[model samples]
Target: MSDPELATRLGAMIRDVPGYPQPGVVFKDITPLLADHDGFTAVVQALADAGRDDAGRPVVDKVVGMEARGFILAAPVALALGAGFVPVRKAGKLPRETHAVGYALEYGEATLEIHQDAIAPGERVLVVDDVLATGGTLAATRQLVAACGGTVVAAAVLMELAFLPGREAAGDLPLTALLVVDGA
Candidate 1:
């Protein structure tokens, strides 16, 4: 299916839960979509397509996924693109020599780290995540990629909280979201 069509179907499968994890915060829960085989495949394929390199071969040398949720989709994307997969985790999660980047979130400040040898200089990278809230995580991930001498080719997410300043925080990088929530 086309990206738009797949995105529309995927969006329909997501459930919205009001006052989740906190009062006044309506969470866009994707469990329903993730549980469906077809939906999950479509979502992953859309993300992979979004980050595809223009060259005859896959352009990205690596795909960097944020800790936890990012792993679910990123691994498949990396395989689809024929690129290596790297994990950007919270501090102390990686045991190897690492490079770290710090950033502030809506709730608190945090640090993310990637292995020093995850990507070589001038390698192309694509960062993947489930959602773009404040963009802190992704911005920090981008910085981590740069510190490792890798170039961020693009960022793709399943959902985007448009009310947040995520796009502004991401700067000039390519950001694509399958579904956008106006006030989430």
Candidate 2:
């Protein structure tokens, strides 16, 4: 379940930038929401909830965040959950040896990498990202976690483009999205 009040407040903060980075695509810009201290705090709290069990105890051992925007949201989520934070970056971004996985994007293909030692064997993980689009990023992140011998218990995104096939692509992964946008 989602909080209607939070959804209403945060949704208002998201600016619809039409034709951003390309034509016919409306980007859901969240810089305004990120700038609001109260809104940001609320979002982090809500996302952190995914890593907790029904008893309200943190159930994950590590929180894995994808490259770029995911880094911003996942770091604080890890802190709130009292779990370790792991960054799944683009290829060659990390100095240490890493495990990498490639996936197809809407426009092209991309690869994601994670430090081989980031997640210990048998560790439980929670994946966090700013948005769920086609679900390629989330799927790749899950593979990276598996490569590192960790299990992803759940995934949380700030927003979901409901019009896309992201939910189907995600398969059976437990997903929680704060907001769902129906169309462009």
Candidate 3:
């Protein structure tokens, strides 16, 4: 579970669209929460907080965000944490030499890419995303970070689908979500 107050404030704004992109799936849309200035700010700040150490230092050198929606929250989180933002894009979206990882999605397999030089060796990283579903995306991002020699210090997500076993999928990685759905 995430922060109860934060979840209460932001969860209600998430709209439900049944059978979106496929059947039998209830998509949780968060555009409404993003539109609310205060809500958005709170969410971003709370996510950035996850990048800090116990001594209140920004221990992360980079914030890695997955493709598409993940980019939205991650860029802001990187800025808030005083770290650089790196994008794990899909397929050929990147323009330079990159490292790629293929992971299993619920329906099939997909690939994600990151720049080879995105993170230096020994640099600490924080992965951010809007949602944590099956954890395939975050796991792929973690592999990319390892390939780049960067350490994934933690992962921060706006919402988590708890029922989906995403936590188990992420293994030992530290995860902090702002909202959690039991049905997820």
Residue 132, candidate 2: how far off, in angstroms? 0.4
C-alpha TM-score for every candidate: 0.92, 0.96, 0.96
**For residues 16-74, what per-residue lDDT tens digits would candidate 1 score against the true structure?**
89888678777778889889998898888778876675654676889989987899889
**Which candidate tops lDDT?**
2
Kindly provide the TM-score of model 2 when superposed on the true structure, using C-alpha atoms: 0.96
Best-to-worst lDDT order? 2, 3, 1
Q: Residue 145 CA error for candidate 2 (Å)?
A: 0.2
lDDT, model 3, position 125: 96
lDDT of 3 by residue, 1-184 (tens): 2478888998789988988768888888989998999889999989998999888789899999998888999999999988999999999999999999999865568999999999999999999998898999999999999999999989999889898878898898899988888973
Judged by TM-score, which candidate is best?
2
Candidate 2 lDDT score relative to the true structure: 0.92
Per-residue accuracy of model 2 over 1-184 as CA lDDT, tens digit each: 3489888987899999998868877888999999999999999999999999998999999998987888899999999999999999988999999999999765468999999999999999999998898989999999999998999999999999998888888899899999999887
Angstrom error of the Cα, residue 87, model 2: value is: 0.6
